[model samples]
Target: MKRAYGLGTRSVAVLLLSVSLAGCGLPRSGPSKSEILAGSVEKLGTTYIVPVDARVARAASKSPELGFSADFVTADVVGSDVIHPGDTLSLVIWENVDDGLLASKGVNATELQELQVDDAGFIFVPYAGRIRASGNTPETLRQAITDKLKEQTPDPQVLVSRAAGDGATVSVLGNTGAQGVFPIERPTRTLSSMLARAGGIAVDPETAQITVTRRGRTGSVWLKDLYRNPRMDIALRGGDVILVEKDTRTFTALGATGGQTRVDFDSPNMTAIEAIAKVGGLNTNLADPKGVFIMRDETPEIASAVLGQAGLRETQRVAYVLDLTQPDGIFNARDFIIRDGDTIYVTEAPYVQWQKTLSVLTGTASSANAITNAAGG
Candidate 1:
């Protein structure tokens, strides 16, 4: 009985040892309370922190004009509507009408006159002559032609058609794969369609802004606005010009990260997490969790003065710092977003710089030894 009892005791001890080792090998079930709190704090600091472009944000958020819903369409197409430049007009004469009566029967407008309206908004016709074609839709232009023909012949038949030209042409230029004029064939041209025509705004889209300049209109449309609301996909009228402005958002990043990098945000509303991913994720062994800063202009005083009249305050102008070290802080790291023109920097732990220097030295020494041996041979 004594030996049996001793064996039982040893068996229990062995089982306890196995359990201890298992705990060491298995992953933790969840983060501790402190980690959760840290993550929450970090996330709160990041989401509200935007870049220094209040002017741009304000401009983008402004309410669009009422009754001008980009989606809205009217059934009645008018004269001031039809055949503008950039519109393709199709002209068809009645088969019953003798060719003697219609001077230009069976002749295509494009073949005859290129069907282009000059900057002065007039298209040269064979008989109708240089008539003001701007703001007139096909039906209205046809009616105008009918009225003109009435003076020469009684009960004249006339047909006006919109061919491929004189509709809407948007110019996509600068850093685009295909930099040229893209004709907006449809009545309403969305921002997405325009980019497609321009070979999709170059690769990565970081350094691109679609600038829309109307021929006679004074104001231009911001490409970023389309991001906020697809409705900002403004309709393209005749002689509209589009510019794919080059990328301007750029910043330098350094410290415990994999490598110092220069990144581009292109435009606004690219969050912190996004910017970090662009430069490569944090170096697990080298990154120090506590140090991250987005550098911006120290122009709060200027911003406040400008906004003071408009009832904006200084408390609104501040950048954010994100801490990643504490396990709980990971939540904030994920939630905190960045905006356009914002820079993200992650600091490396003190030991990483020394390790990197040693790595370089070792590589150099190995190369030197290899070269010396090769020369001896």
Candidate 2:
């Protein structure tokens, strides 16, 4: 009976050990708060593995297409200050020899005529009749009038100048110090120049995003990029709407790292290394070196390029892994771009799970030993 009891006690200890090991293998009682906040989209269905090289290529390919056409930019630079319909012009007609209409006016062979271009794009000049002036530059209109007056007078000189008009204006809206319709005063008015005229960006320029909407299509560029790259400050069109807004691009940091929160991009070109640094890096004790992941929602084009298929919503959530254990992984992290709305997760190490199981087993063994000691006493 004593031997039987000894076998039962041994069996109980083994059973307890097995139970603790089983608990370790099973998933933890629900995901941690961090996990829920940055839950892996992989659970949704299909998750593609994006390599660092592939991610870099994808990021490089995401340059915003020009919203306005080349013709639009050229027009802004060339004809921005040109008089259009609804513009009033001060016209002075002078003749070297007093003759024709100015001579009849009896004013030293010169006449000052204030004329406004009609909606039909014509300005009525006495004796010169109706002249199309809407699309013509002031110098071009002056030449046109001179050519017409040559039929009646000798060497008639004409000066056409803009008196008043709804000058070339762009709507400057959103997070700007002053929001209103800012006139494009100069023919060479560029995006940066316009922003300056509108009191510059109200928010931090590093954290500001600029979007230009022309006609109906929209394109965006980082305000920081515009500051760094002068070429990106394209000329602003007359009707273009320039929106200077706070950067809404954010990524969630989760798992064995700093606190989980949606971290905003300080700049548009944020890499995985930068993102990790933003979140205080990984938890040294619990983080899995091989489990650094950046989860992103892929566009259909990206999904097709990476996963070989599209249409499946599940396939759109891609997980890009960067294993710090590999020698090249750190280098890859520097190149792997972290896109807007990505989730950065550093999973717990497998050894950490084993350690938890060991703790449970140690506690169970201590309890069993105490029971045995009490029974013996």
Candidate 3:
């Protein structure tokens, strides 16, 4: 019966090993590469898996981002002497006679400093009836004042200049070297000049966004684009609000990468290779070089172009595959762009699971050996 007893003991040991492995649960970060492929079958899962190539990279790189529209880019440049209500004006008046009605006492020229424009756009000048100043340039206002005063004094000379006032100023705020209300002066009439006058953007130029809000409409563009594309520097108007802020675009890293977290875009036009490096590369011990995937929700047009198909009616779920083991894999990844809201996942190597299985088997065998030794003793 010794032979029968030995077989029974071996059967028990095998049963225990099976139970132990089942209890361990495999301990995985995410689904394996095989599982991902199997899950993508028709009617089984929703993710459309597409391998990354030069063509796909080109198609996916055209992502929509924040930028100014034609309305903002085509707006005319503001003139320094443009008048507005609440604006301050300085005026000088002269007459053929030594002392005129608007002239200073004992002075041939009358100096009117800090003349405020009323809400109705009118400014009252001594001996010159109230005149509309808003919607007119300093020269135009000068002519109006001259015509009005000429009836009272012959050969009247009038000069009008805009002074620093609550009107015709831009509120510069957020991530700027200096944040406050900046006047729209001669050098600070356009967007670029106004930003410079506010001490420029305090954030990185690559991630900085310059936003302008005018009459309830808003437009934004990268700070670098402002300098590169001159058309983006539109004129600033009175009561216009300007904001400089860091980019809020981000992508998530999951699975076997260095850190499973959301990472912000630190540069413009981020690529898959740059994203990998930003997340601390990959976990060398667990990462599968051939299973790097970037998942994104692409529009129907872009999806059709990437898949070489047409008539995609809705937003398509796309998983872009990358195999770093191939000769051109690194190059392919370098060219593949990573957009905001994408998820990067690197599967664990297959052998890593096998290693765990072997460890479990060896540990069980060692436990059996110890039991046998104890029984013999």
Candidate 4:
């Protein structure tokens, strides 16, 4: 009976040890890194895993919505600086003698008159009557006045100059040192010059964005890009509204990275590698070399093209994988442009999970053995 009791006690201890070991080896509650990567390709849902390569990078880089193009900063449709409504013009008429209609009785035989362009686009003159000045340059108006006065006087000399006009004016608003209507007095007034006149960008120029609204269409370009590409500093036009905005696009870094937080791009065209570097790179001790991922939400058209699928719903989420262990991954990362509101996740090494599980089991086993030995004593 004593031997049988001893055997029963040993069997209970063995069963407990077996259960503890089994618990240590049990599958983890969450999906593994491999499983997550696999799900990216299987079309299990809206999530996709696209492998980064030269071909993939080239394709992805073609997205027009990702970055601003120099094409948008097109040549300013050059227009003559003609007079517009709500303009005040100063007119000077020099008559041959003091008997002309424009000549004052005793004021040096010359007429100095200030006239404003009416809402009907006409400016009143003594001999020219109500002449259309809205679409005419000062020189053209001067010639028109001379022609009109020719009927009354021989070779009447007239001068037309803009006192106050909207012809050379532009509206500058938002993050600028000065926000108001600025006149393009110089013939070579470009975007940069106008911005300087407006007291430059109020925010950090490196992270600033300038939006140019011409006519009814609006386009944006990064301030840094404008500085780098002189051509992008297109000539400014009348009625152009320039808005200086602070950089708002940002990406979040998660998992095993040096720092996990939201990172802002200094420019609109930031690459995946640049983003990683901005956050102090990956956490070498915990990061898996094979599991660098950029998670993004894509439009249906882009998602379909990327996943090679048809008839997918709009706004699909995808994970782009980059294996830093591969030789070409570095180059691909340089080419992979990071868009606004993207999440970069660096997965943990596979061994890290196993090691954690093993450590917990070892601690539990040691505690159980200590209790058992004490009981036996």
Candidate 5:
């Protein structure tokens, strides 16, 4: 009975130990409020500004409401429906059914005219010598022509149209399959429609930026906003060029991360914790959970500037090391935003690296031996 009781006590003790060990392996509860607040203060004490391209700045400088004015209309002419360059005409009697006036061939519906109005914003027509076309449309210009023709030709019937060359075109460049001049047919042409005509954005998702330039006025619009924000899709004008560029910059995150290898969040503003989640989350067995190092190009100049702003001593460097094991550490992860050229490194427990190295070596040796045997055979 004594022997049996002693054995039973040992078994119970072993069972309790096993249960305690199993509980330890389970995930810890999330951090508390005080912990998160402290982390936020430590991680995001200052604002970070990323450098934007010069073209981007120039593009934003112009007024959003640009080029919605006159001076974009065609000429007004009688029988000379077509507006052409260097065409002289004779304005004569119309009521005298016997006047030596001949009907001029009207301009075609498709001819694009490049008519230039004088300082008075008027085009010189045949019978309607000089009439304003800058702020008027074809139908409106026709009425003005009819009024003027009445002076020379009695009740002269004047037909007005685009007259000849009126349409203007602009170019679309960069990251597009088709790069060429796009004609401005309508008065208000949108940016989205233009991009669609140029064979849509790239299949592989990337950061997209568009630069618009017209009459020395320029602006840049983010590609994301072109779809998300309705207001960003502004009307385009003639002589405006659009250049769309892809987002190529990326940072790498490695070790015990959500993903074991490289994870491309694609933005410099990605936080350390966000990057980890993107990869897959921490590997329980291997992750140290405390030492998270964000290795960056901490040049002396940049380091000094950050340090000066941070009010840190010379001994301290800009490269930051964060601990996520402490309960409050999770909050710091949220506040810590990544920069353009940063490498996030999550260290592992001491045994983790050795185990990984051994696994890799074993696999390599096995492959090598198999290849050697195959060659001999």
Candidate 6:
């Protein structure tokens, strides 16, 4: 009887120990507030935490300009119909003399259908050896050719016109109606006009991202912004590459929200409340309305503006907290804007942890009673 009693007590002790150990490793939606503040130090590319308020929301609301600069917007459009190398010129040469240098049988004029301008910007004629036609306009090239032929054939008249040729053009690619090279004509000289000529953006205009690359530099703007801001309708240059694509900016939803996902921007701008709705709102059964958090790496300028303190480090780590339980919490959230790459987190209710502990303890007690009975039997 003494041995049996001892076995029962030992079993009870072991059962209690097991329950305590399991409680330590209880499964959770995410880290608690205290855990985030303590363990997040020097971890997961985050190092600082800051609570958000109305003032911080206003100061940090200013987003970076994502459109054309003064240099691009203020630039004057290039001359229309500028000649370039490898252009095709059609010329009709006429002479008063019946049997002229460029005339045909019983005709006072002759036609040259395709005169391909060489890589060296020179075109060869019947009598005029070779004349540069690259940089000259139709009128100037006609005058130059007339001068060349008038020396041999008296009083020559020439008419010059451009045909389909490899001239000033831009390449439109990626998520556009027509992905090909389009010449920069009078109708398609600006960024907006060129996009229209290419059948506009294939993706939704609200989430469309247009990138223009000229020379070696690149600039980008949202399609909505391009139409809203006239300054963003920059001039297109020769050999510029325009890429229309869907917006890739997204924010991560984690913790006790309805779902955890990396959601793309569906509109030009998204507020914090909209972001919450986007992730299917919080899990009311498990969420702490006061523990909502948004984490991001802010620029030094924005960080100073938000904290009203200068001389901060480059890209300061920040955490904006929102308490939906407050009368004005929802309003503050509505005012707060969600920037790119922000990670939103919601903490679980404190009582949820207590419930897990009690559950483990109840199971342990039942197991202990069974062990005691077995020992006695």
* Candidate topping TM-score: 3
Q: Mind sharing the TM-score for model 5?
A: 0.51
> Candidate 3 — which residues are off by over 4 angstroms?
1-16, 19-24, 41-43, 94-99, 103-109, 154-157, 164-167
Let me know the TM-score candidate 6 reaches against the reference structure. 0.86
- Error at 203, model 4, angstroms: 3.8
User: Mind giving the per-residue lDDT tens digits that candidate 6 earns over 267-350?
Assistant: 878999999999999998888988998988889999888867788778887888888888889988998999999999999988
Candidate 5 regions off by >4 Å? 1-124, 130-140, 157-160, 163-168, 175-178, 185-187, 196-206, 214-218, 254-269, 279-286, 297-317, 352-377
Model 4: residue 102 alpha-carbon error in angstroms: 5.3
Taking all chains together, each candidate's TM-score versus the true structure is 0.51, 0.69, 0.90, 0.79, 0.51, 0.86
Candidate closer to the true structure by TM-score (higher is better), 3 or 6: 3
lDDT of 5 by residue, 1-377 (tens): 66655555555555455445542343332222233334432567332222112332222112222221222211111121332222222222233234423443342112114446544556766545677665565567667867876677556665444522332456889877688776544422677777887887763333566777767756665576667666667665546788877655566776556554555445424666777777777778766676565655544344445434454433322335566766657666666666555666666665654565555555545555555455445
Leading candidate by lDDT: 3
Per-residue lDDT value at 138 in model 6: 83
Number of clashes found in candidate 2: 0
Which consecutive 10 residues in model 4 have the weakest lDDT in total? 63-72
Error (Å) of candidate 3 at residue 108 is: 4.0
Q: Write the per-residue lDDT of candidate 3 for residues 260-368, one digit (tens) a residue.
A: 9999999878999999999989899999999999989999999989887899989988888999988889998999888989999999999998887777767666776
Write the candidate numbers in order of decreasing lDDT.
3, 6, 4, 2, 5, 1
Looking at candidate 6, the ten consecutive residues that score lowest on lDDT are: 39-48
Residue range 1-377, candidate 2, lDDT tens digits: 68657855975777576665664364542233234335444455356565556455455235333233454445435355477777777888887764456665445455556688888878987778899988888898899889988898877888887653554568989998799886666533788888888887889887788888877967677786777766677777667899988878788998888667889888767888888988888888878778787777777766676655556454366777777878878877887777777888787877776777777667666767666666655
lDDT of each: 0.52, 0.72, 0.86, 0.77, 0.53, 0.85
Q: After superposing candidate 1 on the true structure, give the runs of residues whose Cα lies further than 4 Å from its correct spot.
A: 1-81, 84-134, 147-155, 162-168, 175-177, 187-190, 197-201, 205-208, 215-228, 245-247, 266-287, 298-321, 339-377
In the order shown, what is each candidate's alpha-carbon RMSD?
15.9, 6.5, 2.8, 4.5, 14.5, 3.3
Better of 1 and 2 by TM-score: 2
